[model samples]
Target: MTATTPTPTPTPTSPSAPHHQPLLRPMDLAGLRLPNRVVMAPLTRARAARDGLVPTPMHADYYGRRASAGLIITEATWVSRQAIGFADVPGIYSAEQVTAWRRVTDTVHALGGRIVMQLWHTGAASHPDHLGGRVPAGPSPVNPRTRSFTTTGFQETVTPRAMTPAEIAATVADYRAAAHNARQAGFDGVEIAALGTFLIAQFLNPRLNHRTDAYGGDRTRRRRLLLEIVDAVAEPWDGRCVGVRLGPYLAAGDLFRPDAATLADHDELVTALNDHPVAYLHLRGPDRPTPDARPDTAALARYRHRFHGPLNANNGFDRETANAAIEAGTADAVSFATHFIANPDLVTRFALSRDLATGDPTTYYGGGARGYVDHPVSTWQDNPGQQP
Candidate 1:
């Protein structure tokens, strides 16, 4: 990553320039038309109001500034109180929350941007503090041994109480309600957060789930919870407006490892998703690739070969590599996270081949306006009067 430095504003150029041509090209995701192939990945800023877990004006301004991307996936949002684990993250369960998010969607739409909400549930990755002194619920009683972002900051996770069949049914209903709320809030679509060690991912991992009931044990049973949620969430807006995110290469210490069996499980999961009518399958690629690794062995390519739907690749993709991935037919589009933080005009910067600004790590999460909306956009030197 390059350090942020002051540079003279360069002249503005056409976004359809030859550089990174594949990334600048227009794309149609489901029925949604995107101006470019660069999608903004969902990033957790934890900047919502602490009182009701509602999005504030700061969130609206923050997302409104980066509306140039083809699609913006808002930060992971809690679907219900039981889905909460982190402090200050927004939720979509309340009427007040829906109103607050409507402001955000309106701002982005006013600027000609397409946006979606990422539905999330932390499951065992939660602290008792966040759950009102009660242990969080998960598929089993196993502790992930991971940390949770509570009001008191990061705390060691405790073994979660196993959810009953009735509890599972209620949780599925929660997802359906959240999707309805998102639509009411004026979002173009919703993406299910099944990545990492979240609730859905926990159910998918054989090591973390030890239940002998219908929701656990072999691959077929383990995937029941996720499939059920998918079906439930699609009830509101249909599968064409929904996207599913999967992270097969995400490893967290000894609890969740990207071993052969884990990869095989995800391979099966991706193949099974074809049975559903999801708009797209978002796959998180490897964070760090070995120098000897071939493009065919990459997570994006591996899953692209399995899933027949449109594929959106994420994680550690730069302009050149993102274009290459699309050029090789391994990915239909690429989603960027870190880059969008410092460069609100990331699409324009990539179009003109300008140097990108690096984000300040200290202000990445839970902050005021400085690092959130103060990042400068590239200006046109030819038009000295133009402002960024």
Candidate 2:
């Protein structure tokens, strides 16, 4: 069925009542049973072992602390060395990387939490600094004019070499191998990172993908890479255990502007996903909407009728709005990024209606234990009569 297929009725709760939060309800995401609908959105902390691109012991501690989340999507992980865009981010292609991620999954599973690894390829968003001075590969030779987070710091993006048919085939293999590694690492599932201007997204965008090959032409050809990756990933794990993230309205840094054609392409893409056994469609809302604006919610609703599977709304979601989205049936679940960073026990905090701790921006990326795992949990004293 497509993402627009009607889902089972969610638990009935008053959206206005804080004690009756709908986000705390259980959900059956494809085949994975989630305790609550509050999913922890993936956040890149850049804390992996720089040399081997392996996850560290700190990753276990970090993810383990946020085990209360119904589902935790680990930070964007490189599928291969060619997928490298940001410095210090973990990769799943190596044996050591798989072993390291196993520790993280074990920690989260031990705490009774479900977790998924987000597979990523930065494409033109990458810098030569991260790729051993070699230019990155993309759908076309177009330069996104974006910046990449390098070891030295942020570096300007350079024009990427257009991927050949053989190279594209190899990249697809890389994603399949990565999914297999994630399974070996004991993750509950894997999320294909197609959001923003990432590699898969770069191929999906007509503007960035200027190729005259079969992978270019119409919207169907443009989305061929993403579909191929999905089919390949299913070889390692069932589509029921796989999720796809898409950013139809991602206009960050003026890179991926959502024009009529682009938006229509996304609509077709979402509809086409129904043919696959995808567990859920994770849709990112508009970029940087105003605090009071429910544009994210509106954006999700716009596509709610297009997709038939379970829909996970992301970007700038909070406790109340999340509950409202669930109540309104615009989203099956909501994923939180920043709120989850500072409040590891975010599920519990929402249960108790406790104030959340703000994360330290300075130590957000490429940091030690400070901003990574040092966020404190709320005490029982902070919420009297609330059992957490």
User: Which number leads on TM-score?
Assistant: 2
Per-model lDDT: 0.88, 0.88
Once model 1 is optimally superposed onto the true structure by TM-score, how far is the C-alpha of residue 368 displaced, in angstroms?
A: 1.0
Evaluate model 2: give its TM-score.
0.94
- Model 1 Cα lDDT, one tens digit per residue, 146-201: 99988778999999999999999999999999999999999998999998878998
lDDT per residue for candidate 2 within 1-388, as digits (tens), equals 5578654443446443334688988889858889899999989999999889999999999999998888999999999999999999999999999999999999999999999999999988999998888999899999988889998899889999999999999999999999999999999999999988789989998888988888998899999899999989988886568899998888856668898888889889999998886789999988655677654677788788988889999987778888888988999999999999899999888877777889989998987899888888999777675433
Model 2 gets an lDDT of 0.88
Cα deviation of 248, candidate 1, in Å: 0.1
Clashing pairs in 1: none
Residue pairs in collision within model 2? 2-308, 2-309, 3-307, 3-308, 3-309, 4-307, 4-308, 5-308
